[model samples]
Target: MNYMDNKISFSAYSALFNNVDNCIFTRNKVSNQVKWINKDDNDLNIKIKNEKRLKRILFNEIKSLYNNRINRYNLEGFSRINDEKIKDLEINKFFLVEDKFKGTSGQYSVFPRTFYCDKCGDLRVFSNTDEWKHFDVKNCRNKNCNGKYKQFNYVTFCPHCGQIKNIYPKCETHGTKYLKLIKNTENQKYWKVKCTKCGEFIDLYYSFCNHKDIYNLNHSISNEKSSKVMLLPVMQNSIFRSVVKTIVDVQNLEWEDNVDSIMLGSYLGKFNYLFSSNDNVNNPERILEYITTVLKTFEPHKENPQKAIDLGIIGPNLPQIVSNIENTITEIKKNYFDEEFTELTDYLILKNYFGDNKGNKKFTEYIEIHDSFKREFEKLKNILKISEITYIPDIHLISSSIGTNRGVSTLEDNYLNHFEPHWKSKDKDIFKVYSYPFETEGIIFDLNKVEVVKWLIKNKFLNGDEFNQFMDEDEAKNIIMNLDKDGEAYSHLKILLHTFSHIMIRRSSLYTGLDVDSCGELLFPKSAAFLIYSTSNINIGGFSFVFENSMIDWFQDVQLDIKDCIFDPSCLDDNGACFSCLYLPEFVCGFFNGFLDRDVFLGKTDRYCVGFWSIDIN
Candidate 1:
């Protein structure tokens, strides 16, 4: 056969066997022998030639057959094997079929193939197949029919009234020879029943007595049967409503599972949808009010300290839900986890000061303490470190009097400026000397000549000019001293230097301390003091001087005289001729009085310094 394999025809076999006859006898003589081409009749030669044509025809036919078989196999083979796949392909077919059916019919009724007699309550078999065998009853229940009840009949019924009025072939919906009085819940009295068929409540007291045992038809007593009615403990209004209102008022807020979050959870938009839409069956306000009433109602019950108490109207199983919400509310309130408080604290801590007042420093210290407490608060929140109260740091002002008794001040500039020109240094040692001289007569010179002469003079060993300069000042005052003998020019210079030194030391105190020891020298003792104080709280009063006992003792005497040790307002006063008001000459006496008078203070020790006036009363 000329079977097509990849579209290649196998025609070569026919070509090779075209001349080979069925009865061929061949003798091969290679060198001198004779060869017989055919041993059968010539008809066999004719058959051989025709066999090629036959084979060609058969090959074409068989190839066409195989092709057809393969085509049909794939098309129908897969279709018959898998039902689901065939159904998917047939979906379009049903749409067309349904379209045709829909045009012809509105609706139809399907009747039972077999049924019991309505009047007699006897079962009959009107089954479609012979497998449903029928047996004869001794007496037929139908009073009118003379026909024996031996076989099942397919009866016809009226379409309008649902009666089996016709019998041989069949009918739909109606037709009956005798009346069948049905005992359903709707018609009978005394037995109260809810009809599953029509969802109508009926009392079946009258006609239903005959079938009472079959339906368990008693209605007078409570059965205590399981019925899914209403969900009890319907929610009411509450603080929960306020929380939810707050959450809905805000946006994109969510809270964790805790009392705080639960309380605040509503504010975080948990039930925002309710207020936006009035579709809720229960009034929103009333719902919250009811919930609040329920909670408050339960509050007293909790104090009774009994386990597993019944919650009557709310339902027995609602205690857990109520408790959970209560706890969550409590947790949220305890944390003060509100945006307003956080914002206020942030503003307070970060506020900046304007002037050079030390009050700003105290405010800055307050901010530091605030930040530290905030950190601790956050840590406690996350770790749940429970406490009745928390310790918070206080800030106090850096006093103006800190370090007054701590370090030393110098007297060189206060006492030595007048001697500066007449003084000399030999190998870093300064010394004072007196001179009276003439320029040529070294003691007598003009004031300008005397000033230049003094510039070149040495104190330890007076050069010629130093000797002349003092001689002029001595004589200028000598005529006046001869008028008033004790008048002194040197004393005025001493006072000017003293005021100069005091100004320099006071400026240093603005940075370090006022009682600066040896301002010109490198080695000097310095004192520093710090006081701590507290700010107002929601529940507690303010505080001051917050520190340990050791720290207080190290910097100050334990016995603090509240009155004298208090900050001095007048020390900053500069009205009269006290130390602060002193000019050049008076500055000397005031500075000396400030340094020398022990009465200016109480006694102090190396271990402790009494502040301001004294430890003992005047």
Candidate 2:
């Protein structure tokens, strides 16, 4: 009956370490279920009202995780949740519950209360927690039997209903009251629960139920018999999969600056040729050019009649143009004054990070590393497909789990066990979604867009004319950023950058002192960049240590791993990613171990695939 202290970290609430109303596998002990109850004045609950960009995106993602019949996602404006007593409640807010716990401390109860006497083999179920705790100290409940008790290690999980409970097998003649649970050491699949009085037994591995949820879901339950219910170990790791959305603080900074810079396109009325990379619109000289031209409009007599604009004048509205340009520019510069940070502000911000202006610019958070190692980095940048390598040390990564799924890994449509704990006000109808903040070091690896377009062209996934469509780098960059996130171009770029991030994390783990599991990847697919940063909060001068000591070495050693995979053609299913090579732990990847392709870098061995290195840059 030995066990580790029942303790959990604050950060764990936002991660898989421990979740609200989920079971946790205790060391040398039966699994315990824990949950968080929302309180009005609970000081321990840190209100997560910051990181608006991350928050809105996170909310949209969580909303999408649940299969609402109406589908609240991508609905032009913010979703107005009309609560109808359907337990899902309204996802209007969030909070970070940490520190000395309030609701969940020592509140864990023994799960799968069905325990059996190893000697007598009879089942004992406990419906009362206090009585169970009192009698748990003693042995077998049978008279004159002092057999050691063993908690049933398995439970029935109703994926659709999102409920877990001990399996109760009943017989036609004699009920489950006299049931005996039996486990065969050779195979767990053969475990069974039998009626001692009738000798009739039912396999525990085969279970059933009409899976339903607290939410009034209108979706039809699966007719597929196997999917009706799942039998799994009580401590199975896949019981809960945490769904979290993260954005680097640097991305937040660039997101605001870049969005403002893009807005400059509307003011100049330069929709004909939008500026792109290098933020040409944000260039001081570029700003001056527009400013000097606009200032000329202030001249009274000098203002030419052809240029004299009025909103009422159909042909040339100089007055309206001048006012719009001035206000837009002034608003753009004021972005520097923002002090508060947020995760998500609106859903529009998720699909359109550049051109969309619905989100409030109430946050600022970054530094780019290059000048110090410009010469050394030039070579790294010269590496094939390496468009740019920005060393960002001590990055602020704000991440939070929006919800979790059971009996499945992804936030799929109609999740089986979607558990999103509501940290809402007892007095109000608001629900608080929590997030955990970590300061870590990272490196941003951006793939060359031109080369990617060329590769996509080679793969015949994109039109070849697109490469030369825009000569101005700014215009091209603008078009690229403005492209829909779910479009073909973004998907191609996302897969390439995601795969590159995985390989780099593996290589960085070997060269740097950081463990692979200690790192996390945040991908900026639109910009064709991926960041590999530390997840462990105890930052030991995180990425700088790697950047200063072993960054160059990482690039050198990457080719060695990418050259070949231990499980070659077999690993080709994922386009060349397997655990033996590019595969990474689930935590390190932000996209839930998806959108990876070694073919993006290695080129399909048997096909006409133009990988990152397929084209010649030397």
Candidate 3:
């Protein structure tokens, strides 16, 4: 017989050989040598040719031996034996003996299988080979009710100390304490122990009972658990609705080209399909159930049963279970499908910012105009006067504020923490920033016509000697030279745009029926553009309506408002800015309300330096 032709049959025979005697065959270093070790310390060595005939002969001999033993023993199910009975048995030393006794398959041992009759509450141990073969189909042997047997590992605890008895045997803290089985009021069996050290009764059985009661436990164990569970139902509903809304929003977004929209639509379709097919995605109850099941299996074995009960694992601790379920789902989503899901999620956020007609237009125009503007200017440009303007309506705005308590604002902080030079810098050296989440309706103001900032050294508009007194001539020159050599002009443009953005936000809020605190600014200094918008948590379209209908009035007011401040001469002289003039709400200003000086835009009152607008004369 060809080994290849009868490979499937031979594989079945090999499995049978493994299950019956817990013996495995292996090839020795020398060719044609086969070695077998049985659970009874019996070893069989056979030498044969490297042919199918010899292999079949060896297999048949092993099978015959196993069958003879089975006939003699006539074993049924699992047989209980004392430790001394298996002393000479060739058990695999590396295999966990406990796992074998639990009726789980191990590297060695056979003729012992354990199962519990769920309905009859009867535990059965089978020692027969035929019983193991038919274990799954067996029914309860108890009288009056025959229920199918469920495989379960029997757990026992020390009556004296409540520690797991079989595993620990002797507890160092409590000495040798043997567990005695006792019955509860319901006649259900349990293990109990009393600690001799303190004469305190430790109820191991009660802990197991508590673990079983998790399905019905009502009270929450912790505040965090309560909060998470309460939020789970709401989060589940919100997440599904958000996914659907995102899909619809992606569909309605006016892409510049059909191809981009089509590609995005295709991706959204996949996301929708994935969510729809997974029933658990929107089912908080199902997620909670899964968490409970996993906790029962793993947590009970590793943690104190009472602790698990307290966590609501053996009870209705909805919040704790909800958190676990949420974490599990998040991990599954991340690992599933190799990060395509995460990419789609990021794309959805991108669509939210740039999906509308106004957003699309502003984004495209900014790109086109910035590229042209960068090449035209030798140095950074500042707003001199508006030559042309277009108002994009219904642009969404998001703003956040940060303070010292909340650490640095991710949106505004620029200093690198990991940079070696800056690592030693103190918090006082930087502005204290914090961000509060805010969202609102907004507008985009498109502009054309530009004026470039002049080199600070050549500007003789005011008192040069006074300017040098404040900043060293060499430091000022270096700042200007660095702007040219390393393209620091971009930073100058950002400062100009940022300052102007604050002015517009302040002025626009005054006329646009919004408070200065409610208005926010988004700066695109690299593009030499900025947008002033609303940042109220509620989406009131008042600002967008004003920009759409009365933009000319808003623009005129902004220009007039920035010409001078109520605190000017002083505001312009001392740091060139103040709360009455330059500073808006921290949320409205992007750079933690720092790095602003009206003199950068408007020429200084004392004419110590020329502004960007003043450079037009030279």
Best-fitting candidate, scored by lDDT: 2
Candidate 1 lDDT tens digits, 1-618: 111111211111111111111111111110010110112222211122122222222223223322343243222211122222211111000001124322311111111223343344333433344422333333455667443322222222111111121122221232222223233443222223333334444321222112111123352112222222211110111000000000000111122223123322343333333244745523323334444555655665565424435435344545665676666566545644333222222122211111112222232234356564445433332221111111123221110000011012224332211001111222212211111110000000011222212221221112353233336633432221111111232222222223323333323223322123212110000000111121111212222121111111211321222112222334322111133322222111223233221111222322113312222211
What would the per-residue lDDT of candidate 2 be over residues 1-618, giving only the tens digit for each residue? 422223443444314334544535454567765554233243443333345455454555555445442242221112334423234433332234356654333234566667788887877766655556665524777787888788776666765445555665566686556878777765655677788877788666445664332132343333333345666777634565555567543233323423333333443344312234555463333443444454454445234545444432233545555556556556544432211112111111222233222221110111134444555556665565665554554345556656555544443444334444343543324554545555555566656666666666677766667557433545545445555554677677777777788887777656666778778776665455666777664666556666555566677757666767778767875456666777676655666677776777777654336767767652
Which tens-of-lDDT digit does each residue in 1-618 have in candidate 3?
Answer: 111121111221111212111112222110110111122122221111121222222223223323332333232221222223222222121111223232222222211123445564444444445544544435566567678654332233221111121111222465433222222354323333444445554443233211111223452211121110101111111101100000111222222122232232333231222234645443322323343454446543354555666766555453454344445445444433212222232233233332343342333344355564432222222334332333444442211111111111122333211100000123212211111112344554422212332334334422345344345433443333223211445455556667777777776655677778666565543224455655454556676556445444554544455667788667767766678877875434545566676776566555335565555432
Root-mean-square deviation (CA) per prediction: 56.0, 8.9, 32.6
> lDDT (CA) for every model shown?
0.24, 0.54, 0.36
Write the candidate numbers in order of decreasing TM-score: 2, 3, 1
Off by over 4 Å in 3: 1-383, 387-390, 394-440, 446-450, 453-488, 557-560, 566-568, 605-608, 615-618
Task: Please give the clash total of every predicted structure, in order.
Answer: 52, 28, 29
